[model samples]
Target: MRGIAIRIHREFQLMDCASALSIEGLVLEMVGAATRRRAQGLSVRPSRWIREVKDFLDEHFKEQINLSTLAKCADRHPAYLSQVFRRCYGSTIGDYVRQLRLDYASKKITHSTESIADIATAAGFYDQSHFAHAFKIHTGVTPAEFRAATRKK
Candidate 1:
């Protein structure tokens, strides 16, 4: 984990658009390893309700989502759903949704010639600026930089 952190730090320092994909991959790898380690210590599996909630989020992450609506769908209290989701996934529902959106936007940015604003809207971002902010936070580069960097590879 420490080595991953160090590598990520080095990548960030470089701020090379081409390495952005590698950085995202490294981050995912680190998160997966951490999640696995956390899960291994647990004695019980995640509940079916939690799994269902996760599935719902996976499918609807690009759409408007809220805890109350998810709570109603799951037949559970919002607080309970939030708590269980965090316990099972080590991340809040909102964080998970944002990650999904970012992942989708990154792929579109890299694979298509669409305008940034268009891709942002398609990815469920309210506007280009918001998408750029989130994209930079998640990928360590702006959409244009990511696109240019990936294309250079």
Candidate 2:
């Protein structure tokens, strides 16, 4: 992981953030490498298929996700996909998606002036109330309160 970070820093110095494709490629490689290492270092070895499912979820978390759809994409049965995903990642797919949305919304809430409704929409929530409820459950604070706390740093 440290080596990947150093390589990424070197790549950035050579070009800049303007080369978003290069940066993204580097990041993907780093994540893949790290995942492989984690699987090897852990008690259980994760399937390569689970890694593919994880990458897909990471890329499409903002979109509506259906287990049957994901199963088709992964070429696995929906029940099997859910089983492997939980074993490999230690969370259900739905919970992972919810966490991803909340994390993204938290970043935007702290750094951007967007309204809570707009952030909720962008984070793939159907409505602000739902987003707020999920966010508060995950973080133990409402979005507005979290933002204010972050801004004080």
Highest TM-score model number: 1
TM-score, each model? 0.76, 0.71
Please report the TM-score between candidate 2 and the true structure. 0.71
Off by over 4 Å in 2: 1-43
lDDT of 1: 0.80
Relative to the true structure, how large is the alpha-carbon lDDT of every model? 0.80, 0.77
Q: List the residue pairs that clash in candidate 1.
A: none
Clashes of 2: 0
**Tens digit of lDDT per residue, candidate 2, span 31-113?**
88668757755337678888888888888888998999999988999999998787666568898888778767877997899
Residue-level lDDT of model 1, residues 21-74, one tens digit each, is 988989999998787857665325788989999998888888888899999999
